[model samples]
Target: MTTHYLTKLLRYRAWADQLTYGAVAALPEGAAEATRATIFGNMLGTLSHTYVVDDIFQAHLQGRSHGYTSRKMPEPLALNELWLRQQAMNDWYLAYAQALSPAQAAEEVSFQFIGGGDGRMSREEMILHVVNHATYHRGFVAEMFYQVPAKPPATDLPVFLRDVSQP
Candidate 1:
């Protein structure tokens, strides 16, 4: 993809992430930590997992080890802490995308996956994977919100285009 296409996608990713985290943070005490049967176990677990994956892919893009044995976070961060970390990662992605030339964006990076396999993907592919992966988990968070009996913010791409996109 062109830099503009990928930058727009990443920007939307950040916008939607902020909306998701804000909604969760606004919930009553014990809401995020509530018991649940979802993957990662609950809202907090799922959110932390997403950040951990971002860190993994960040390391991959840098050609370094992520130093994690598994995708699961050893301990979940507090909601505010997770929000800060995710925001920082989101900003990093935006800058990374903005700095890439089209040729550079297509350059391939080779790295090992956390689960013990060698892997390679173009810069564009890696970034797309991050965006898609987080979008999937954000859906998880949205479902968890339903369990909490709260309405989640609409984070769909069309919504981003309508509300947060640059003309």
Candidate 2:
């Protein structure tokens, strides 16, 4: 994939994440931390999982150990703290993508999965995975919003492209 496309994807990822976090934070007190029927436990839990996974892939792209044993964090971060960490990771991803040349984007990297297996992906593929993974979990967060009987932010890619990202 082209560096231009990679940069755009990361930008889209960051935009959607910001909107998701805002929606969660806007929920009534205790709503974000309330236990839910989902696997991650609650809204915060689901978002934290995405952050952890993003961190794991960040380490993979850097060719370093992520030092994470699982996709989920042991302790869920509060909404404010989680947003800070997520913002940093999102910034790192954007910088990394913006710096990639065509050759660098296509370069293959190998890493061990948190699930215990060898894994390999091109830099472009890994970036795609990170963006896609966050989008997938944001769906979970959006679902939890319904449990709150509240409206979630419109984080759809087309919305981002039309309203946020410029041509």
Candidate 3:
């Protein structure tokens, strides 16, 4: 896809990330970190994983090491801190996508995955993967909220598109 399209997708991803974080923020204090039976352990665990992966890909696209040895931080960040980090990372993705030339977007970035596998992706593909990967884990966080017996902010792509499409 074109860099222009990539920017739009990144913007959508940022919007959804904000919505998800907002929903988590509105939960009763401590609920985000409350232990649960999910792959990432809890809402905070899942959200931290998203941030970690986003940072990893951000470093990849920039041709730098993220300095992260695992898929998540050693200690999960506090929800507010994690939200702020996620915001900055999302902003980075938006700016990075906007700055790409079509050729640069297609440039192959080779890097080592966190799990010890070699990996390569075009800048565009990396952008798409980051967006898709975050969306996937946000689903896990939403499910964690249901265990809290609260509804989450709906973050479907169509919701983002329709919400922003209107005047």
lDDT, candidates in the order shown: 0.90, 0.91, 0.88
lDDT of 3 by residue, 1-167 (tens): 98767877888888898889999989998898889999888998998998888888989988887899899788867888998998999998889888888899999989998889899899899999999999999899888888998998889988978887332
In angstroms, give how far residue 39 of model 2 lies from its true place: 1.1
lDDT head-to-head 2 vs 3, winner: 2
Angstrom error of the Cα, residue 123, model 2: value is 0.7
- Ten-residue segment with the worst summed lDDT in candidate 3? 158-167
Spell out the clash pairs found in candidate 2: none
Candidate 1 per-residue lDDT over residues 14-63, each given as its tens digit: 99999999999898889899988798888999999999999999998877
* lDDT tens digits by residue: candidate 2, 33-139: 99999999999999999899989999999988888888999887789999999999999988989888889989999999888889999999999999999999999
C-alpha displacement of 130 in model 3, angstroms?
Answer: 0.6
| Alpha-carbon TM-score of each model against the true structure | 0.96, 0.97, 0.96
Instruction: Select the stronger candidate by TM-score from 1 and 3.
Output: 1
Deviation in Å, model 3, residue 165 alpha carbon? 4.1
Collision count for each candidate, in order: 0, 0, 0
For model 2, state the Cα shift of residue 161 in Å. Answer: 1.1
Instruction: In angstroms, give how far residue 114 of model 3 lies from its true place.
Output: 1.4
Could you give me the TM-score of model 1 versus the true structure?
A: 0.96
Q: What is the lDDT of residue 14 in candidate 2?
A: 90
